[model samples]
Target chain A: MSTDDVDAWVESARRGDRTAFTKLFRAHRSLITAVVFRMLGPTGDLEDVVQEVFIQIHKSLPDFRGQAKFTTWAHRVAVNVVLMHRRRARSRPVLVEEEAGGHEPDAGLLPDQDLSRQRRVRAFYRLLDKLSDKKRAVFVLHELEGMAPADIATEVDCPVLTVRTRLFYARRELAQMMHDEPALAGLLAELELAAEGQEQAADADEPARTALGQGRDRRSDP
Target chain B: MTERESHDNIELRPSSEFSARAVRHVVAEVVAAPPPELDWARLETRLLERLESERVTLRSTPPGSLGALFGFVAMAASVVLFVLGAGGPAATRAAATDQLVDVATLPVIDDALGAHSHLAASLAPGSALESGGAARRFVLPGVAAFMLAPGSRVVVRRTGEPYVLELAFGQVTAEVVPRHDTDAIVEAFIVESGGTRVAVHGTVFSVARSPERVEVEVTEGVVAVGPAGYRGDTTGHLLAAPSRATFAARDARLIEVYAPTRATMAAAATPRRDPASLLPAANPLGISRLAEPDAEREVHVRAASRQAPSAPGRDVRAEAVPQPLQGNPGTDATSPPAAGGEPSAAGAVAMSVADARAAMVSCLRRATANAPAASLSVSVSSQITVTLDGDDDVATVQFAPPLRPEIQGQCAGLLFGRAVAGAGSSFVIPFSSR
Candidate 1:
């Protein structure tokens, strides 16, 4: 788990040592799977896509200048591969059932609670698919992965303003999409509660102001 | 996870905070789920094989060189020895062994298989097949042939108990071959993954496995999914084709979700409890059956699970699709279906009555395409009232008049497949073919 060992493996893997590459693959396998799953949704072929990312990493390892942490670079690779995979799947926009590993069964959740949670997630992903890949990447990295806007900007090689803009637009689009799905009653209820709570807080001081505080639409100029 | 006031996305509008928190809340299961060991094992094996294959490719000697000549000679020697051994005593031993012998080298009795149902590609033993983009068919020989969906990886093991294909990941539909004496001997083959060996029951079914869950969907007949060497009828779950069984696992604990379709609607009909009435409360339709994966009691449980408080009445998958209700196996249209509980769910993705009728007409068109070109007038005069009772997500009609029993079944299959919300809904369409 030490960075020095990982760096050594990267050094040897760069020299075409299969053992070193295997070690690298073992270390980063889970990280890559999580990245692909979050970026591409559960329907994405995790194993195949992850295998592809590693292969790409193996091929590109020599050029890896050790500038960024290996995990960050791997994340970038996963995002690129997932976007490419989505491009090829343009004809079939239908989402398949969430793969077995998409989520672990939560023993803590009652059967009904688990089902409700799953349906809500499925609804969210269906809406998430509507956004373009760039918007999806930034939004997923920021929202789902809980990365900071600055870190996301660095990961995607874009500006913080661009990342923020994509996150805002993606959220707006998802809210619009979720509005259409009544099955998203659970999530919608939460959204309403949050919006209502915020409105109440804002209205307490500014009694005349009634409109909800809209997040600033940070649209970057083309 | 920050408080609403300090939420990163929700600086002011709660919508941003809602989106982030909402999605995270729902996906907490996935975010925290660890990769199943069986899945990791399969992936690791494949990765090692692939890396080794590529390594050989990278290090192979240049063509026409002495080293290349030696490599060619070695390959040729192995092929010759294999052919000889396959033809010699190995062939004799293969015939005598009860499925334990290597069948890859032996000739498959294709004549014994159903006509037009043979494998697309006759695979050699230990051949690893990957469906890159299109579905590929692999003959399980004496038992059946399975169509591997695109992006699936399977390895055909032909050693001992050779009638097995290890599905590393992805979906594969196996259509069990018809046999005159099929009833006498069990039509069993194994699709092994995740330390589970699913024995094929009679008919067509698909088993889709991921690291943490395995889904068995029956489209034709029933399939038996249980431990290795388990009798499907006696010990295993006889998952009918019209149903889907999802076994989801968290560490050692397992969660099961069984969603029965309209194909089994009559068997799964509920008392007239209105779903719209239940919609305002906790999602009654959003329910799953939690059970220990290894518990085996009786067949009555499977039948009984089709009804009552935990009715296998509605499918949770309908919400995953955002488009109109499209074609499923029985539901022939490319549509999205909202979860079929409330009218709102159906209204979200339910295809129109007009669209459904059009699809029905198309089915008639295909059936009647080869009918004499001369105009033959056939009018369906009776009002086929597709009724959806309360909890009965299934739609049934009181076949008004001269409708054949087969046609009633077919039409029922169509409507039941469209078990959208709104029980007291009514719609009518007229079509005449001359």
Candidate 2:
């Protein structure tokens, strides 16, 4: 959900409106899951992370200053929660990603057909997976999400220089991986062009996408 | 990337050859849509549990709002007024001078003396009575003779041959003489501001009473502490033997306790028949027992002031149906219906046993009185007689077999434990498997 919408719902939820809080959760559930799942991974228990994020928001909501957007703060909280879970599980790691099971979706692995647009998109994500957790996070936030390098560094609690270095390394690694694999590289190029075209289309549909993003931002705030 | 490009599937476009190549390779290896729809029921339950626990902790030590502090201060002031009393102007003036640092207002009282304004101190033959501030010491000639503190009262119904103190009060302690046969017994009590009273029999126990709560410690004997109520309530619940306690105003509970000594148990066991089996129906709250012959012995037990029916002589006898033993051998005797109709059958059995044991112990004394040199061990058996209240019909009678004195001692401990655990009076008697 957007900051304004979240701020509105938060004010109502604090007043004891249960429906407002549920509406908030339902609208933002997908965004929360995406953020949590990124840091936690498919096998990572994101429920705990999501719950912690909301609970922390609820507990600390009374202290919110409205200086920053609720979505920004929520993203920060989601990252912290997933990091904490990772730290706790590091000793006895139990990664249960769908890749290890028959339940794996068709979108996961590379297809052997003459590459389709969707297939190329899937291939690009496959390349992104090769980067380390920290580097991948920086790439997604900086290059993909276009978040400011300074803000990404602050969110990850790292030096801005480190965020830039990680992003640089991630991009270099992706370029090299694509170049080394000829067949995959051709598909990757097509996918990148298609993505650029979609961006144009999405900008044309900005008002609609903005509405969906705003709705999501609101629910995930608190 | 521009905002337009970033918001769209920028990496998935076919026009950007370099970005497309990278995106394809990334996508080829990227796992399926991440499993984001996690089962949250377990997390929700855990959060609820934590919420409940947090609430309880918060409630136990709630932050006092303005009115709450006022209530606390008011309650505290009232207690101080009641304890100091209107008559003690000098005490009140002195209290004002030391209001902040007065030992009386200390958050927690250390021992029996700190908790009570009135205290009973019984010194054995050689023990010295220490005079403290504001305390009026009562010196009894021997262990048998007892003293009552100011604002405290006790009734001594009878004195055993060896001399034992029968104590009932807000606070009292007796020094035990190893050579003597009796220990101090304190009964139904009310500590000025404290809600509970602890009664100890056949031991050296000290009690401290405060307005909101009472604390008791048995330095060397057995004690029973219960809640002696206020206004119209009298069924004071006992606060059982707590090794040490920091009681608050709402502390009224029944606790039964026994000091199990191998030597004492051996001595008690040597005696034939269970002393508890001989408990007297007349004194249901009896704590001490002695050998008595087939003669009259003075026994003291508490009944509601209303339960003591009027009679021409000390010996008042009334009859009712004796409760069936069921599986218990002597339970019927313990639970005989009172002479005047009252639902005290449950408590009566233990009281009756205490009385009968004391009576039987007196019988042994009588048996030895004729032959001073003979120290023959004696066991007493009692029978419960149930009488038809209205008519002169001969009701059924049940014989309660005797038990060894030591077994009675164990029963005393077991009973006290159960009573304390159940927070009730009357020995919550426990039985052995055998």
Q: Write the per-residue lDDT of candidate 2 for residues A47-134, one digit (tens) a residue.
A: 5457666655655666767788777666766666665444323212111222311132354445654234344444445565666668
Q: In terms of docking quality, how is candidate 1 classified?
A: incorrect
Best model per lDDT = 1
Model 1, A101-200: lDDT tens per residue? 4345344777887677656666677777767778887877766677788777887789988887787777667766666766575676867788899988
List where candidate 2 sits over 4 angstroms from the true fold.
A1-8, A12-20, A87-91, A95-133, A143-145, A177-222, B1-20, B24-434
Clashes per candidate (backbone, < 3 Å): 11, 93
Off by over 4 Å in 1: A92-98, A101-114, A145-166, A190-222, B1-38, B59-434
Q: Pick the candidate with the highest DockQ.
A: 1
Question: For this target, which candidate reaches the highest TM-score against the unseen true structure?
Answer: 1
lDDT of 1 by residue, B286-316 (tens): 1121122321221233333332222155543
Global Cα lDDT for candidate 1: 0.46
User: How would the docking of model 2 be graded?
Assistant: incorrect
In lDDT terms, how accurate is model 2? 0.36
